[model samples]
Target: MSNYQNFPPANEDGAASTQMFRAFVDEPAAQPPTAPNEGRRTGVIALSVIIALVVVAGVVYLAMK
Candidate 1:
């Protein structure tokens, strides 16, 4: 029906296709990277509280039994 439905454009002109390719593939990949520890602090505190509560509950259960 349409040429796009078949082989499509191969970017033979190299300008619009290269721009499209870089826009979808390369540009977003060029984002500034974040530190491994950037957003881990809050999660660590919440997890620590959960772990501590479980530990305390276990200790109390053992003492009562």
Candidate 2:
């Protein structure tokens, strides 16, 4: 039973536990300090925009014909 339930002893005041919980909850998720893929993301966005433009132009051309 003890092996299955190994855990740390609880704080007597409980304030520390509450503060730790609050700090953890309030903290923002960790993000990469630098966006190494930012350039790749921008390139993908540009390619998607270009593809969309080509599709729209093709539709317009078909409609005109």
Candidate 3:
């Protein structure tokens, strides 16, 4: 009754079209983290840590008031 349970069109022989329709199921991807990208990510992480420390120090100073 629902859309999920709706039957596909039938052929003249009464066979459902769904039998001919194959879902394009993909296999698991294989994109490993590359060294170049990892290097860039490490640089970003280092920069973020430095900026976070600066922000925390500033917040502590402001909160001290």
TM-score to true structure, per model: 0.42, 0.50, 0.44
Judged by whole-model lDDT over C-alpha atoms, candidate 1 comes out at 0.78
Worst 10 residues of 3 by lDDT: 18-27
Give candidate 2 regions above 4 Å deviation: 1-32
- Superposed model 3: Cα runs more than 4 Å off: 1-34
lDDT of 1 by residue, 1-65 (tens): 64665543675653577667767886544668777885798789999999999999999999999
Clashing pairs for model 1 are: none
Residues 9-63 of candidate 2: C-alpha lDDT, one tens digit per residue:
6644344787788899999999869988999999999999999999999999999
How far does residue 38 in candidate 3 sit from its true spot (Å)? 1.5
Error of 2 at 53 (Å): 0.3
- Candidate 2 — what's its lDDT? 0.86
Per-residue error for 12 in candidate 1, Å, reads 44
lDDT of 3: 0.72
Ranking by TM-score: 2, 3, 1
Regions of model 1 farther than 4 Å from truth: 1-38
Arranged by lDDT, best first = 2, 1, 3
